[model samples]
Target chain A: MDVRSQVSMVFHLDKCIGCHTCSIACKNIWTDRKGAEYMWWNNVETKPGTGYPTKWEDQNIYQGGWERNGDSVSLKGAGKLRGLKNIFHNPYMPVLDDYYEPWTYKYQDLFTAPEGNDQPTARPVSLVTGETMDVKAGPNWDDDLGGSPDYARQDVNMQKLTPAEQEVMFQLERMTLHYLPRICNHCLNPACVASCPSGALYKRGEDGVVLINQERCRAWRMCVTACPYKKSYYNWHTGKSEKCVLCYPRLESGQAPACFHSCVGRIRYLGVMLYDADKIEAVASVPEDQIVQAQMDIYLDPFDPKVIEEAKKNGIADSTIEAAQKSPVYKFVKLWKLALPLHPEFRTLPNLFYVPALLPSVGTVNNGIYNSNTNGLWGGIDTTRLPMKYLASLFSAGNTETVAEVLKRLMTVRWHRRNVTVGDVDEKTVNAALEDTKMDTATADAIFRLTTLATFDERFVIPPAHREESIEMLENTGDVKGNTGFGFKERPARGL
Target chain B: MFNATLNQFLFVIFPYAALAVFLVGSIYRYKNKGFSVSSISSQFLEGRKLFWGSQPFHWGLLILFFGHLIAFLFPRAVLAWNGEPVRLLILEIASFGFGLSAFIGLGLLILRRVTTPRITVVTSKMDVVVFLILLTQIVSGLCVAYFNRWGSSWFAAFLTPYLRSIFVFDPDITAISGVNSWWLKIHVVSAFSIIAIIPFTRFMHFLVYPVDYLWRSYQQVIWNWDRRTIRNSTKHSEGEKSTNN
Candidate 1:
């Protein structure tokens, strides 16, 4: 019986207000130690600019994960599969400085009196060793698009094209621009786990949560370099590497991860997933564009009796099966098919899905404001009208249509104050608000079916009294109707 | 009378004492630990790159020390082998070059320990002190080399005979003549201080070597008694369950 429990997450980008509540929550919970001052386990970054810790996505500088090889996939620069047989080492990984140099301001620098001054000035100083320099870069530098305009503008070289070419470039730049909030993807094929020389890192079989055993960590730091997301951090003082654990303690108590729970936008959803263990590699290796759809196809249908039978045979608990049957991710990702995987090109088969974001029209800015009818709130500075180059700098590939589509979807997912008196607006009202003010009935039905059925299916069933009694009796007796624990009664022992 | 007193103490007493302590102490420490021909063959065959580098550096430095001891112990014999001027020139050159090589090798070894992350993490505080002391020894040795160049024959005639006389347990009252040069005094004081510090510092590595060298070759053993106990308990429980059934 191979009862492998899988876990997954979805982040509705539209719900994210970019307030960095999640980042702050994660910092206060985990990274607020002496050596961990610079780590932000959860960070929000604006698109178009090189992210915090600078140029993280540029794999050329910090090689990580695997690259495509024709129709197959192989670890980056590792020549062939046969050559990889004896080689147990993984080379690509982040260094200590790949995150940021941890720094703190000295309070003495603020209170100390200047040589000639009558009173002390309240200026901040580096708290770490009292060295004073303007420390700017750290995690989450892109929060709230602080440096958006620079990323929005197109290059002059792009403008030198003919009218048609310029028009295409403009669209390309505008299309490419969108905000990307990132966190540990908790990849299905986690390179960090595979690369650890000591086997100190493991993905839990119960919930598929990855963890590092600090006791076993010899500080080789291979996990730091293997992670493409550059999420792992090295503690210089402790001489060990640390990373996100996905708040397992909280999850066990039926609460969301700290970052997810504290998210200002209420964009995160936690759920169980059931997948055929055999199909994981096959689905993950599919080409990038088809990956999201391929992953959805691999999900076992909850309604199938065969699946339930097989699951029971495999020793899967009823509660886990119930959770998978009702998972919101299974709905949005597999049923309604509205969500997309972040950076499918990474090839780690990331579980976090995003409902794409859509931006309002360029000319519709009312004093640089855009109103979201779904949330009944105003967003600052409609940058949709910005030039293509500027947009290109924010979003990779300079694809405006994809950016707009993603933003629109994201806006729908944003947390709006639930309307209590409105008599429970049907899926039509929600889909109408989401689908550009003119909702199609079929789309609304699909959304409604997913929202309600997915929720209903996820609720775990409390075992009936009779069933519990029977199970407990069987367990105590070590026999159920003539069946022994191992499915056979002990043979008559040979004469001692 | 000054020359007679100087020759008695410097040539006879101090040389023998320094020689006895350095040689007998090192040899006794090495042999008492059961290090012998068998151990030497094992270590020589199994030593790593760091081991090779450290071994040669210590051996070369020790040989250089003996060269100094011989000049002080038997000034007349040394002068007979080569003229006094020629012997003085060779001693000065050899000591300078030996000190330089030791200093460079120590620097490379220290840097290797520091810059290699894994190695740096394992380094102890005592290791740092030992490196600093060796550095001081090299710098002070260079000072003595410089002072010898001004008048090698004159310096050797005064210093060597006086040092050899120290072996006779006679106080060299006149060896201090013209030794007022602060640089030369500093060199002498620092050399004696370094010798005193060697046993206490990571320079203790020299005392422990060859024997300590074998410890690295042996595989580390870790016992898990707790897990074994748990397995035994589980087996006991399983046996009881079978008996009940």
Candidate 2:
């Protein structure tokens, strides 16, 4: 496998407290300017509620991403493949209002005194009409990911749901709903990077981070509409599109991204994962159900000596190899095999992965509820009387069968034990599963290995060679040039 | 000092000349540039709320402008029909109301331009100019409405007579004699200047109205063969030899 090829991220949702510290830190660093106030490079959202500007997850309104057409992948809603052959641009993206309206206080109203007032009261007003208004919705409106329970309870339509339906929905909601703190996933097939009319946006080969060349951005805002995630924001003042840079400056000096570094929950994990750049299209174009497996197949095993030898041969830096060897991402994502990508159906091959949350629930036996001796259930109480439908809906999209299966799987308390690696499973059991499933040995071995690791490593330490060089370069040469003589040279040079 | 013939040329001929320049220049520019009917159609068809704001702002401003134009054209006819005192009172009230509407509408537009992220991106220097000019006209008109002197007789005896004299091959600078209000002169001059600049700025939307409305109501042409044929005819010459040859 080509070594300087792929990039991936792993996020541990268990540690996330939904404080929005990452969002604010990112905003203060990148998007607090005149045109960028509406852009939140990092935002944590509550699921099952109207997010930010509103229901952004409803892709029916703004069609984006790719869809399957026969054996080939094609842009959804785009009429013909031939017509899209020389695509100057792709359509269907979110506008500024799709996220949130830019709001400002009417400063002039602060000095205006009431009819009988002796002193001017500092009453904040909306600058739009010099009228009194309040900050309503914008970025980070639902950082906590509070489920639709609150909205459903109050909504007339939700209130009308049948008792069974409500029960299933609520259960499903509790099981599925979790705070998803998102930044630019910097996907393998980034819609924003592909749709740029000027080729201004690019994903760095070294780190898999997407960046926009501010100088080249002509402000057509095509990328703004093409991104399914709505990560790209148009800078109105500068007449350019801007997005999360993934804090390359910080990363170059061996530090985490601003959002990841400032995350109060320390939920974010930054590292390098080698993937087959050649297989990106194939993996991304696969059927939705098969996509997760395709992605898993692409994750390189850092411990494999053959993979390491191949990486070194392909001119992969020793530092990068070292960094990848002990990366927290590798441990949590590949070693544990617990982290899952957000909306794998997006077909962007998003690098960011989250560990599927496990919630508490009582096991149903015939008609009676068998309460599990676990604190996983909210308030540590049996909730079977509340209607299984609600719980099913919340957790498993009303698929009680799947909910039961998942619940059974999660109830195996050994899986929840800290610092347990998938590799610790008995070889006999792993071989038995592999044989029973007719699965490939390597795949079975990797999955088993991932489940054995104990504890998530927080340190994203770079190799000493790369770290020292990057620090020295940053200190001496203020700007890091893009090309950096890595590829054009015939052979890998000795370290400076 | 007031030549009847010169006044006829100045008030009557000059005003019409200025109006003709404004009207013809705007129309010519609109025709030459062609209407951005596609853009308007797209906005309206998309069920965009901006169209609602833009449509009302344009229509309100148009009605307001025509009201002033009619008053300028036939002061005596208006007064005779309603009597001088009633006419004067009506003009003042109408001007005040018109100014208020213009002020409010323009304020909304400016607010949208400033606050709406998408609109702010598309806004140009000409858009700012058009907004500010209209705002100034409304402010000046309101000032004139508030500080009227001699009421009905002043307009009938001085302004109306002067306007009529200018039409009859005569000039009468003395008609403006009693009206020493700097505010009135400032208002008149500013209104005229705004008219002159309208053709150049996005204020040309005023001239685009009826034609734009008619054009937009029509459907888009979607025949591929017809479009290709038109493209070939417009882009290529039949007599030209092939470049390879």
Q: What is the total number of backbone clashes in candidate 1?
A: 61
Q: lDDT of model 1 at residue B53?
A: 45
Q: Per-residue lDDT for A376-443 in model 2, tens only?
A: 32222235333334334332224344334333332232332311455555555444433433444554
TM-score of chain A of 2: 0.72
State each model's C-alpha RMSD to the native. Answer: 15.6, 15.6
For model 2 chain B, the run of ten residues with the poorest summed lDDT:
B217-226
Tens-digit lDDT string for candidate 1 (A309-411)? 7766654567777877767777666655566665555566677777654444343336777543332322312344344333332332344444444444333
- For each candidate, what is chain B's TM-score? 0.56, 0.62
Candidate 2 lDDT by residue in tens digits, B121-175: 5567866776776777777766766777433334565566665654565656576
User: Best lDDT goes to which candidate?
Assistant: 2
